[model samples]
Target: MKKYIAIVGSNSKKSTNRQLLEYMQHRYVNDVEIEIVEVAGLPIFKKTRDMAIPEQSKAMATKIDGADGVIIATPEYDHSIPAILSSALAWLSYGIHPLLDKPVLITGASFGSLGASRAQAQLRQILDSPEIKARVMPSSEFLLSHSLQAFNTDGLLIDAEQTKWLDSLVKDFAEFIDISAQLNHTHQEDDTRMADFSWDEGTTDKEVSK
Candidate 1:
């Protein structure tokens, strides 16, 4: 079964972005298993060259490393992503760099007309960092503007058009994850083959000295 991590950027329990992530988990949109990574308990990252990151945060990175893909639901804060999410990303950037080349899907919900598009773009920049290098899905953007109206009291999307878009996004994300994994595998195989070939062609030290 495909495994994924759904991350909500906001720290608030009543955050609409968090609600959206939870809704995705409840739906299991693409027949995949999801584990929601909560940002509330994470320690705010401090840039200290000497100190190791919080153990819990390190463990969170490890969880991300194990997942096949990540879904980041974010909220905008003055045309940018929330600080908690940025801090989490900072923590993930160092150490083992668990998010390196990982497949990712990004979405956001907000009360404004633009939803969280600007925040998502900022997030994409962070994900594109040299240490992170996350592979974001290029085509789909789930911008839930006027978020409260989009969902019903039961926490389900009410509009048929929006529902259809979500379904397609989830399906595309799943396929993207699979295809990326295959490509990584193929690259690894190629590297291994090249290494083996190089080893075979190398002369022994004794022969080289002669």
Candidate 2:
């Protein structure tokens, strides 16, 4: 069976983002193997001289590296990605590039009508950075708006239209992984660049920002 990593991009105890991913996991149990990974409890990322990262972060990176594709379900905070999600991504990329050339599907759940649209946009930019460079599914946005009421007692999506849309997106994402693999001629180049990447030597944070 094809394996995919579903990242719960929230630290909240009752995050709708996590619920959305859980629904997908249960609904697609026969089609694909979905492993839901949590971003909670990870230490905040800080640039260090030794470049040492936490073991948990390393383990997550290894999992992602082995997966066929990735699904990130995010929740908006202050109209942007949660700090915990940002920290997790930073740890995954510092001196390591498990996401490089990996095919990714972006999903977001929000309490309000906007459905984490702004945060998803920001996350796309983050994933498109030189070190990460994940092959995000283009022109696709799965926004779970009013997510609090999106699911039912059985954890299945309540609305038929929304469920159909999500189903189609998942099918498209599976095909995207195969297509992205065919277009992976630059993988070696990206790996080489990521291996050589490092924080600006001897530069203070303030100076770098200037």
Candidate 3:
């Protein structure tokens, strides 16, 4: 069975984003294995003098590296991803690139009608940045609007159409993972270049001219 890491991109005790992933976990139990990961206890991102990465961050990166693909469920705050999720992504990228060329699927939920659309767009930019380089599924998005009423007591999606849409998207993601794996040659070259690049190193204009 193909395994995926589903990141709950929220720190709230009662986050609807978590609920969305949990629902996927249960609904797709037969089609795929989904392990839901939390981002609650990670320390806020900061630059250390020694450039040390926290053990917790390393552990999360390990999990991501082991998984076939990733699913990020985000919630919008002030039309952007919550600070906690951004911090978690920062930790994952600093000096380590587990997400480099990894396949990713993005989902978001919001209480209002917009359904975290802005946050998801911002997240795509972050994941596609040079440092992260996550291959997010193209032209695909799953947004749960009015999320407070979208689920039932059992944490299952109440709307049949929504469930059907999710089912199709998940299947597509599985195929996408397989296709991405076939491009390992390119992925390797990108990884090598990323490993050689560093944000801390830069040349002056004089050095560039020389």
Model 1 ranges off by over 4 Å? 185-210
Q: Write the per-residue lDDT of candidate 1 for residues 1-210, one digit (tens) a residue.
A: 788888888898888888888788888746888898878778777645344688867878888978999999999889999899998887776444677668999999988999899999999989987556788988677999998788889998887887788889999998999788765644445334433432113666554344
Residue 150 error for model 2, in Å?
Answer: 1.1
**Candidate order by TM-score, highest to lowest?**
2, 3, 1
Q: Give lDDT tens digits, candidate 3, residues 17-112.
A: 999999999888998899999999988887564558988889889999999999999999999998989999998888899999899999999999
How do all models score by TM-score?
Answer: 0.84, 0.95, 0.93
Off by over 4 Å in 3: 202-210
Question: Which of 2 and 3 is the better model by lDDT?
Answer: 2
Instruction: Give the per-residue lDDT digits (tens) of candidate 2, residues 81-189.
Output: 9999999999989999899989999999999999999999999999999878999999787999999999888888999999899999999999999888899888998
RMSD of each: 9.7, 2.1, 4.1
Score candidate 3 by lDDT. Answer: 0.91
Model 3 clash count equals 0
Model 3 vs. true fold: TM: 0.93
Please count the clashing residue pairs in each candidate, in the order shown: 0, 0, 0
Stretches of candidate 2 exceeding 4 Å from the true structure? 202-210
**How far in Å is the alpha carbon of 141 misplaced in model 2?**
1.6
Error of 3 at 174 (Å): 0.6
